[model samples]
Target: MKLLIVGGTQFLGRAIVTAAVAAGHEVTLFNRGQTGTGLFPDLEKLKGDRSTGDYAALQGRVFDAVIDVCAYYPRAVRELLAAVETKHFTLISTISVYASNEQLGQDESAELHTLTDPNTEEITGETYGGLKVLCEQAAIEMLPGNVLIVRSGLIMGANDHTQRFPYWTQRIARGGRVIVPPALDDAIQMIDARDEAEWVIAKV
Candidate 1:
């Protein structure tokens, strides 16, 4: 299958590219070419910037499937889908879209956070989750029943630029008692970046 990936140079995005290549799929990448630029030297990498809404690199491109990993606003998603053609569209959304975390075992039926200012392009802690909800809606609007939304939880694994998981892992490896979070009883949910990437390619 031919696949196109948006932002295929970082974290989960890099994992997706790796998984797709291993699975024998032809892949093309569309990103700003500013990060992990040295990686994936053998694949086709298009140059574009979503921050500025520049999708010229993808104009006339078509793929069997497309996985968008960097869509943070509804406008970006709408413009991106309009720029390319694909049989299936996969959006790498987040669990943050859920309005309430108090309820246990909530599924996709759970209510999503409402965006007070859908027109706002500013992405902050307060508006991030709501914006993602809107982005998901935009994808559905653009592709209808052919869209797949993966509301993934905190993604953690190799190639993580945040250095978050590595910090804790290295600290614990130092062999000394450490300060632990007070909420030990709280249930933690997360997915390995590689695992999620593999699952996405399999679906494609």
Candidate 2:
């Protein structure tokens, strides 16, 4: 299968590209060509910026599936959908879209947060979750039954620029007293980048 990955230089995105290549799929990446610029030297890498909606490189391209890993706003998703032609669209959403975390075992049916002003595009701690909810909704409405929304929890693996998991791992490896948060029995959920990437490619 031929796949087009948006932002295939970062953590999860890089994992997706690696998995796709290993699975014997033809892959093309569309990103700004900033970070990890020369990683995938063999595969095709097109230069474009989603912030300015400059998808000129993908103007006449088509793919079997598109994995959008950097869609934060509804407008950006809509613009990408309009620019590309693909049968399946996999949107990388987050569990943050949930309205509240008070309830246990929240699934996809759980209520999602909504912004008071839908037109507001300024992303902050307060509006990030609600904005993601809107972005998910936009993808679903635009793609109808052809969309797959993966609401991921904490993602941890190699090439993680945030160094979230690595921070704790290295700290604990120092072999000294470590400070842990309250509730040691708290259920933690995390998905490996390679695992997520493999699952996505299998679906494709």
Candidate 3:
């Protein structure tokens, strides 16, 4: 299958690209060429700025499936959908779309954030999840039944810049007095970048 991965240069996106290539699928990456430009030299790279709404690089391109990893607003998703019409569209959404973080083990049926007041600038934990919810909704409306929204938990692995779980892993590896959060025993679910990539590729 031929796959197009938007924002396929950072941690999770890079992992998805690697997994897709390993699975014997043709993969193309579309991004602003600011991150991981040196990596994945063998794969196709299309340059465009999302913030300025510049998608001229994808003028006459199409793919079997598209995996969006950097979309944070409904307008951005709408622009992408208009640029490329594909058979399948996958979105890398967050599990925080649920109304409250207190809710655990939530599935796709959880409540989503409103796009009316989405955060356009810097996205905090709260705003990021909310905007993602809106972005997912836009993609669903644009692609309808062909959309596959993968609401991911904390994504971690090598090349992770977030350093949320990596900080814990490093602390545990150092073997010292680790400061536990208030809810230490709370079930914290996470998906490895590779595993998430494999799942998305399989679905595609």
lDDT of 1 by residue, 147-193 (tens): 99999988899889888688889988998898889987977777889
Evaluate all candidate structures by whole-model CA lDDT and list the values in order: 0.92, 0.90, 0.84
- In candidate 3, position 138 carries an lDDT of 88
Provide the TM-score for each candidate, comma-separated: 0.96, 0.95, 0.90
What candidate 3 gets wrong by more than 4 Å, as runs, is 115-122, 172-176
Worst 10 residues of 1 by lDDT: 183-192
For this target, which candidate reaches the highest lDDT against the unseen true structure?
A: 1
Candidate 1 Cα errors over 4 Å, as ranges: 175-177
Residue 115, model 1: Cα distance from true site in angstroms: 1.4
- lDDT value for model 3: 0.84
Cα RMSD to the true fold for all candidates: 1.2, 1.2, 2.0
Q: Total backbone clashes of model 1?
A: 0
Candidate 3: tens digits of C-alpha lDDT, residues 80-133: 988886889998887777776776666778776654455464577657777888
The residue pairs that clash in candidate 3, if any, are: none
